[model samples]
Target: MKTFDHLSVIGLREWIGLPELGIDRVRAKVDSGAKTSALHASDIVTFYRDGETWVRFKAHTGTRRHPRDVECEARLVSFRRVRSSNGQLQERHVIRTDLVLGDQRWPVDFTLTCRESMRYRVLLGCSAMLDGQLVINPGQRFVQGFPQTDRTLRG
Candidate 1:
């Protein structure tokens, strides 16, 4: 995508995957209104490594009966105090990683949180869209096409 030249049109919802983070088929809701992206992560643990903070979390993707477990570890980028759609405030762990959508892979910074209550497992917000690099077609779904399962599993 050309920065400031053209915007990549995407649909309302897309199946995005983070292969490096050991997550595949993360059903994400694309929201241009939201400022930052968030992922549904459980059993979050934080630790220090050589004076830098690192995180370890488990991602359970897919349905309850067909669930898949993926263990992920990433360097902690920041801690963000975010307000939810329902006007609830919480501090969340922020991490930077690459996300694959369609045929493109790009770095995205996202907050780690428990989004189990939400319909989608992930939320792709405006900030991660790179300030107008993406245009959302609210009426459509999977404009970039479905996810290709080419990733090898990691623990």
Candidate 2:
């Protein structure tokens, strides 16, 4: 009998894309230690737009000084309490969305948080890296395409 394998195993840093949100070539940290994927978001405000539930938040991609507030309409999935590396437990907003890694795309749940100090704005966790797909090379950076230069123009 053969044991089924899942996920090609990725390194700490890798390039990822959120095609559903029109984001391409965004740097993401693959942290198996984390249970849920996290995205750097600030000033998170949830409101109704066009009679639909939507969320508006600011995100700092490449730099912490420069933050871009992006508005995305996502269905509220669940609320979870997560503990940070510093041992701080906080309630976070989780939403289900699509993520593109290498040549594969799948649905993933991302938590909203203000990760201003982190190097990468996007952090992909274990649940998001399932199915024996992504293989992250630690020594390698930007395995696929180049990162986007303009965050304001992400549409």
Candidate 3:
């Protein structure tokens, strides 16, 4: 396989974390075609805090089958109308948080929604890929390796 030494080559799926959001291990479907990543959030509620918007939600942080829920709170980035895979438009609460993937780390925005029926709780969309830094191998997984630590050492 051709290599781009500067790029982190990942698989169709990988494990990532959102420690800032209290999600230690979330299986993410790396979907390049998706514009904005999504999080499997339930019981979402909006509230005001220090003149800023905040949201409280429960998300599945572990595997789909052996799921573990994390109660999370984050500053609301915005409220957006997002189109679902089935082409239905829905209003969603968006929040920004740190994404821990393998040896690298970055901040990403996630649209909150109930993804109980989906295979994965998180969807790593192109926006979160951060300027084409990811090269996906369609047949592989954990290309960056499952983060050995619940939270990565990387900043």
Candidate 4:
């Protein structure tokens, strides 16, 4: 077995468990083609929370129903127009938060968007995969499953 001091530039797409958020087996795509990571969300509404910039959006954590729509909020850090895979540029709201992957955890900037068509719910891009923090195993799936704890900490 080989031990890695730092993640290789290839394994960023492997399955990551966000146990703190009760998200398990979320298939993410590591895309160097994008500048900001994207999470599948719906019914996105921007609002003010505690007199601070915030946004409320729905998230699906690879489940059928029950607690399907998750309302998440984060400080409005910035918004930028990013070109999509199909060459259609769209403006997206970016938020910074802590992401846990395998034995590694770090702050990541995620762009909020309605990704109803994309196969994978989460798209980990270059901006998030920087600093050799992740190693994507293209031939692997669910490197680790998230714990079944509904610790929904608001971002």
Candidate 5:
């Protein structure tokens, strides 16, 4: 047996927080196969803020039966042409924001796209786990538990 003492172990599905976007507890699906993380966003609009491009969109954060919508705005990182899971290419709006998982918090880039049919609102891809801080346990779920609201964990 091997131990990754320096890395935190998380399950396939975990509760995450996007503090910058006012998202406190959104379920995220950890996908090691994907290179970029994605957020379920709709009604995406771009505007100028201080001469820089910014994006505003509505995020669906809840389950299908009990839907929750959060209107969010973030600075546009770039437009990326990414291939979807179904082998379709599409241009997506990219934004960088802080992601809070359990006691750890860090900046993670997420591509904005409509994922109305997906179960999870946020997709945690390989890029988000590339810092060598996370190791996923495919057989488990919510290993890190829900993110705390404490200010100290906001880092």
Candidate 6:
């Protein structure tokens, strides 16, 4: 048997954090099949920030029965035409943000779109794991545990 100790093992689902956007906790579906990550967003609007494009939207981070909204604003990376899992082509707003999963934190690009019908609000795609830093265990869940956050001051 061979092992890659340099890679972090993550399950099909994990808890993650987007500190720059003030997101303390959110469930994400780790999908290597997905080329790009996505976030469930609504009321998406674009504006100019110092002559650069910026986006503002409301992200749904909770279940449909218990909805939680988080207002987020980020510099627009670009508008990408993506084919959804259902085979629908649509233009989506892309934004770069730091993703915190367990002890590892790194920048990731996420496409903002409506995923109301999906089970998970966030999707961690293959591009975010392209650096060969992670190995996904399909049969497991939450292998990295909950993402560490500084929400509570350590004393």
The candidate scoring highest on lDDT is: 5
Score candidate 1 by TM-score against the native: 0.86
lDDT of 4 at 78: 85
Could you give the candidate ranking by TM-score, starting with the highest?
A: 6, 5, 3, 1, 2, 4
Off by over 4 Å in 5: 151-155
Whole-model alpha-carbon lDDT for candidate 5: 0.91
Report lDDT (CA) for all predictions.
0.82, 0.70, 0.85, 0.66, 0.91, 0.91
lDDT of 2: 0.70
Per-residue C-alpha lDDT of model 5 across residues 39-61, encoded as one tens digit per residue: 99999999999999999999999
The TM-score of predicted model 5 comes to: 0.94
lDDT at residue 81 of model 3 (Cα atoms): 96
The best-first sequence of candidates by lDDT reads 5, 6, 3, 1, 2, 4
In the range 1-155, model 6's lDDT, one tens digit per residue, is: 99988999999999998988889889999889888999999999999989999999999999988999999999999999999989999999999999988878899999999999999999999998875399988899998877776772241
Instruction: Supply candidate 6's per-residue lDDT for 106.
Output: 91
Better of 1 and 3 by TM-score: 3
Query: Ten residues in a row with the worst lDDT in model 4?
Result: 146-155
- C-alpha lDDT of residue 103 in model 5: 82
lDDT of 1 by residue, 36-136 (tens): 99988888999999999999998766655566668889999999999988889999999998888876778898899877677777899998787437877
Q: Write the per-residue lDDT of candidate 4 for residues 1-155, one digit (tens) a residue.
A: 99776664345445654443345446677787777888777777788878888777777756343335566766778898988777898999887766766545667877877666666778888777784365556675555444222342233
Q: How many collisions per candidate?
A: 0, 4, 0, 5, 0, 0
On the 0 to 100 scale, the lDDT of residue 36 in model 4 is 87
**Model 1, residue pairs in steric clash:** none
Q: What TM-score does each of the candidates earn?
A: 0.86, 0.76, 0.89, 0.75, 0.94, 0.95
lDDT score at residue 135, model 6, on the 0-100 scale: 92
Lowest lDDT sum, 10 consecutive residues, model 6, at 146-155
Local error of candidate 2 at residue 60 (angstroms): 2.7
lDDT of 3 by residue, 1-155 (tens): 96788888889999887878866667899999988999999999899999999999998776666878888899999999989998999999999998888867788999998888889889999988865488888999878776544445553
